[model samples]
Target: MNITKLIMVLICSAVLAGCASSNSGAVYKRGEARQVQTVKMGTVESVRTVKLEGTKSPVGTVGGAAVGGIAGSTIGGGRGSAIATVIGAIVGGIAGSAVEEGVTRSDGLEITIKLDSGGMIAVVQEADVQFKPGDRVRLLESGGTTRVTL
Candidate 1:
């Protein structure tokens, strides 16, 4: 493939892979579809804004390396080209990881809920919906995962 096309493909693949994962409370994984969840009533004690970090998967790193190696191969001839390719790959890997993280990072919320069962617990999830103290909400629990919803 041509250099530009290869670079575009690599970038697109990395981005798509990163987007495939989610921490949103409203999104459910395939395995969670048929499972039952325990529902608990609660009052929102507080809602604090939080930052959700992105995926650190190898897709970004490998894609970046491939692109960088190709670009660097065009730099010079013989041993010099090979060395440039290695350096380029290393730099590209680091940059790709950072780009992936930035692109996939999302705003989240740390919610402190006072359960009606007389227990206090906190859950952090993507801030797709607004929450404030004193709002009535429900806690859905299943397979060691908990999500707060209104």
Candidate 2:
């Protein structure tokens, strides 16, 4: 190959390499906000749960991919144009699904207890407990809210 053609190929390869590396190891943080509510101590009737459903739609994925593929295809034309667009759409859908999965949340439960002080303390409980429904428990209150730690 001529020196000019070799140089052009090298430049194109470097640009593509840079593009590939640009998306590597990207980290995103999602925040959760909890509201505190006060309750009086009462018998531990039942553990109540708060269900958080995933709001990501599969249509959103395919739609976003289709749009991105069209935009990508516009930049590359001819016999490879349709194929390139389809590939772009597929990649975009997978990326969108991953993002949606990261944001999806599930249900959490909080325990309610009646205190000897005649006050009710409802506490958010974590999974991994050896206690049953009728087990005697202690409530710890912080910032006007209580949690059953033990």
Candidate 3:
């Protein structure tokens, strides 16, 4: 029964891992300032919807393999249990990886901008804000990252 509970927890973890988005392409809060610099001034040239793939880590595969191997080991007798454990671990690893990828998918936006410096650039970020053509914006730099904001 301990192994069964362990398997359940791992399954839940795999599901949750796939559903998590680590704000790779997200917006910063208004009025929230950090050690910041303005990278550029620009106008929105276009906005397009895009998809952001979810995070993929070995955690899911390892967890699933452990659970699968433990569960499989409980079946049959002697050598049969060992064979089942290996098969189960293989199947579980594949299924867990696929699940993590599918669950973590997210929608984003590709924003094309025409900079005042006479250059064009595009940023793909989580579509949490509405942007339209001709909107004035600025590129804020914090650390090694840049964000486009009004």
Candidate 4:
């Protein structure tokens, strides 16, 4: 191949490799913001049922893959390439959706705490609290609530 063609291939490979490693150090900050309070009064009036919403179905992945495959095939030459593209898309879509489903799930607690001021607040608590519907608890300001062990 000519030097120009070889240089183009090398540049493309470098760009793609860089793109692949760009998100290696990306991290997500989890947990809620902390709050400090001098005095707070609350009584667990009643534990309410908090139905956690199920994750969204991974329909987007399948849809995206199918769309991508069709777009990809258009770049190659001829009818055979178009057919290959559609098949590739169908396979990609199923694989992508499966991966998406594996990653999305429920993560926290849904609890309703009633304060002494006759005010009520609903929040997600830690899983280790072992709180159930009808459990009494005390709301703490440091992003946590203590189950009133009675």
Candidate number with greatest TM-score: 1
Task: Pick out the ten consecutive residues of candidate 2 with the lowest summed lDDT.
Answer: 20-29
Best by lDDT: 1
- Candidate 2 residue lDDT tens string, 1-150: 255434643543343333221111111112212434353334564577654444456644654565546545765678688888788778866765554444454444566666667766565543334334665665544354345534
> Candidate 2: which stretches are off by over 4 Å?
1-43, 52-104
- Whole-model lDDT values for every prediction: 0.84, 0.50, 0.76, 0.47
The TM-score measured for candidate 2 stands at 0.37
Worst 10 residues of 1 by lDDT: 11-20
Error of model 3, residue 75, in angstroms: 2.6
List runs of model 4 lying over 4 Å from the truth. 1-41, 48-78, 94-102, 125-128, 132-150
**CA lDDT, candidate 1, residue 72:** 75
Which lDDT tens digits does candidate 3 get at residues 1-150? 685857676676856665575444354545545655757899999999998887677866776677677777787889998999899889877777777777777888799999999999998777778889999988876666677777
Candidate 4 accuracy as TM-score: 0.40
Model 2 lDDT, residue 88, Cα: 75
Which pairs of residues have clashing backbones in candidate 2?
Answer: 39-120, 40-119, 40-120, 41-114, 41-115, 41-119, 41-120, 42-113, 42-114
- Cα lDDT tens digits, model 4, 58-137, are 45355546554754465557987787678767765665455444333234455666767788876653233455655555
